[model samples]
Target: MYEKYDVVIIGAGAAGMMSAIECGKRGRKTLLIDHAKKIGEKIRISGGGRCNFTNLNTSPIKYISKNPSFIISALNQYNQEDFIDLVKKYKIKYHEKKLGQLFCDNSAQEIIDMLLNECKLANVVLKIDTKVIEVSYKDKIFITRDNSKTYLSSSLIVATGGLSVPKIGASKFGYDLAKQFNLNVIDTVPALVPLTFNEKILNKCKLLAGVSANAIISLKKTLFEEGMLFTHRGLSGPSILQISSYWKEGESLNINLCPEKNIFNFLLDKRNTSPKQNINSIINSFLAKRLANIICEENQIAGNIGGLSNKNIKKLSDSINNWIVEPIGTEGYKTAEVTLGGVNTDELSSKTMMCKKHPGLFFIGEVVDITGHLGGYNFQWAWSSGFVAGQHA
Candidate 1:
């Protein structure tokens, strides 16, 4: 009635493949299956096809979870250095782009191919385009059935990922499965996504779309300093995306267009040297001409004021330096790079990534509550968590 295996893992993304390969290497008869036609589609399309595989400066501190310390043990067990050594062993040429984010030199396919080759060498069986229709537990075995065959295993690892980039087969199947097993699933939201604005800000963003500037974006006490981009929809680029993970609904973001300069003081100096000169001309020297105009216009300034009072200059300074913009919402999972939450860490083992109460069930990758900052942090989490689960599964 069923084909038996020591381990049956669902999903074939980065985490799934890594877990499968490790399980096989440990002499377990491993089977990895996925509903999608291609395995590692996320890897194939990441980093603009170059695949930002991992971050050299990866630490548990970079990850976000309800239990902030949940990532410690796994990250310690299989760190970024370990994964990098494996990449070195395969001779995959990679380069560090910025902030320790490592990417393939040619294509993301290299990373996928490497994982596939490792899976084959470990004798791990991968079945693509096979959707599991039913899953049930019997005695001490986990029985999972596809349209073609039923698989029985002692261990089941759920690496089904999360609802992000829906066009790539991302879904809530992972969360649903966790709930089916009585595991607590955390509320999820879009992370690392562009923030949309109201009609007035939307028009300004549309007018300044494609314009980018080095900026510091802050929400409450959290902040990110990176390149910010304006889009027709709203705000995007690294700064906005990084802050989006921490930004909540109905919260206004404090954005500093000029991080290094004290604009208020700069204007005071300029007032004496060229009091008659258009203030817009002075602000343009620091910010883009269009952005400067918007700030002046929003503050009810015409920029041609000769001998303007100190009060008027302070308003312009505040508008440029402490610009406040509240996002109506995000672009949603359609454009989100990752999901913010899933299978609560409290219900899972930090060291093994296995369900604490459900003995044989394991959760890893984006399916878990752990989410990392933008860059290669999420990929590192995938490798570390998957590696630890594979060792125990």
Candidate 2:
């Protein structure tokens, strides 16, 4: 004997919980399930405890996908404003950090508790630590559990997310499920992660570990101007993480350590005016001292600025302004903030997030090929896609 639900949702993360709440609100018997013992582990650790739940400047331009336009409908239907209204309704204290990124003033648990409370109000059933070993569909959806109990449903929603942060239960189950249903799956890669370099570059990073500087990190046309941090292994911080999404192996990145200053011109003017100033001391004014020392050492920039010829000045300037370094690889899924690709966008309807070939089956969130830039755009996608699918699921 099995207790059936009208809608069965897998992975009780952001999307799954939101979808379940909406489905329940619509008078559908919804069951949200997850294998993890603790719910919202990702949310718990997000923004260093205070979750960046949404972004005010969310637009199609901020997201990366094969078909970027696919997210328009869902995002329009349930925009960041709507989610922000909900947060306000819950009276959750929040503030905008920067670039429209909103984080709770207290803990991320406030957001998690809000979703759980909403689920409770909507009569959504939640099952954690319930592993579904298998899923199949033949007119009706069937979920086979590890406990030998099988649950059937009219509609199935897969919100299993992507293979990022494996510690939080991110898996390829969603992608495999899409393939099982004859839907196209995109090749996945780690995104919003730190870039690692060869020993030469790593050694410099190691020396300047804990040092930070405002930088403009660019890969071809794409560029992010933000804070960059030197790590023991390689480069990290917002600017590096943002660029890492677009960077591939063997490609060089043009990093401007001093984005505000025209280095070559600054040096020329400095040489003309302050003839007695040390070149290293001048660079240290704009950049971190440790990093300036490294740059000075690299360029063999010694002693006074007046002693240097134009050639020596240009060499030092180019090294600081156009610091080209190629990353050998990334930190990978273990440290990635999100996954780049998933089920092909063409495989599902953008309006409803439903599989084109399979009726009553849906995919949402990071599993659906719509990876947003760093900040809360990805979470907004989760809320939007899940809300949209919930309407029809």
Candidate 3:
């Protein structure tokens, strides 16, 4: 026997649930399925459980994609306000964290429940712990597998997400489905992940573990100002994770330890005021004692500020402001919050997320080539893309 529906969505994640709800709202038959025993594993663990669901300041500039304009339509169609309204309607209390990031006041499960409730209202059917073994198209019908059962649908939406946080059930299932239908895929890489340093630099900064400072990291012409944390493995925190998206092997990372001040000029002026102060004392006056000592010892500049030559002092200050260091690599998908690249955006219609060659087949969420910056940008993509596809798919 063959079961059928107007729409069949795979993954049952943030994007899948949203799409399913939309389809059901349209009075179209829809079924949402996921291989995982639980839905929204990533959502449950996101933002340390609060779930960064959207960013108030989200824009096209904050996203990385082959064709940046591809996201404009969907983003403008269903933005942060639309999702915020849903949250409010469901009485899911939330607060805006730093940099326009919106997080739940309780647990991320609230967001998941919101989506599920929306699905329920629309009468969308959900099947969990269901695995899709194959996908094929014939006679304008899409077929999916779940071990022994096969289902057919007129519209098939792939919201399986990307290969990040695999422990939470992330996989390349969407990419594989896109390829099965002959769609092009971009090379995938880890994003919003920590950087690992070489032994040389790791040893030098070993004692600096657990230290966090406000810094600006520059990579490939992109700069981010946020907290940089020194970890036992390497560097992490907001600044490092933001820059890691643009980082490549062997490329140097230019760091400004004191982003708010001009270190060289500040030191030069301070020297004139306290000409009798020692170099260590002068550094400690402006920076933390431990950090100041580490900077001085790393550069091998010695003695009191008054005893140093003008050129040496200038160099020391310059090094503090423009420290250059290169990372060996990233922590990979195990720690990455999202994948940098996936199904090439060129292969699909930006407005509807439907493949140009395969109509009625849509690829949404992180499976697309577009990847957003750290914060709530990723979730916004899931919402916007899923919203658009749900309308037309």
Candidate 1 per-residue lDDT over residues 75-98, each given as its tens digit: 889989999998999899999999
Q: Against the true structure, candidate 1 has what lDDT?
A: 0.91
Local accuracy of candidate 3 as per-residue lDDT tens digits, 279-393: 8877777677777888888777767676667787777877778888889999999999989888999998988999999989999999999999999999999999999999997
Candidate 2 per-residue lDDT over residues 1-393, each given as its tens digit: 777889999999999999998999999999899999998888889888999999999999999999999999998899999999999999999999999999999999999999999999999988998877888876566654546567788899999988989987888888988888888998999999999999999999999999998889998899999999999989999999999889988899999888888888998899899989998899889888888899999887889898988898888888878889999999999999999989999989988888888889999988989999999999999999999999999
Error of 1 at 124 (Å): 0.6
Answer with 1 or 3, whichever has the higher lDDT. 1
Q: Which candidate is the best by TM-score?
A: 2
- Taken over the whole model, the C-alpha lDDT of each candidate is 0.91, 0.91, 0.89
TM-scores for candidates 1 onward, in order: 0.97, 0.98, 0.97
Worst 10 residues of 2 by lDDT: 139-148
- Candidate 3 C-alpha error for residue 333, in Å: 0.4
**Clash pairs, model 3 backbone:** none
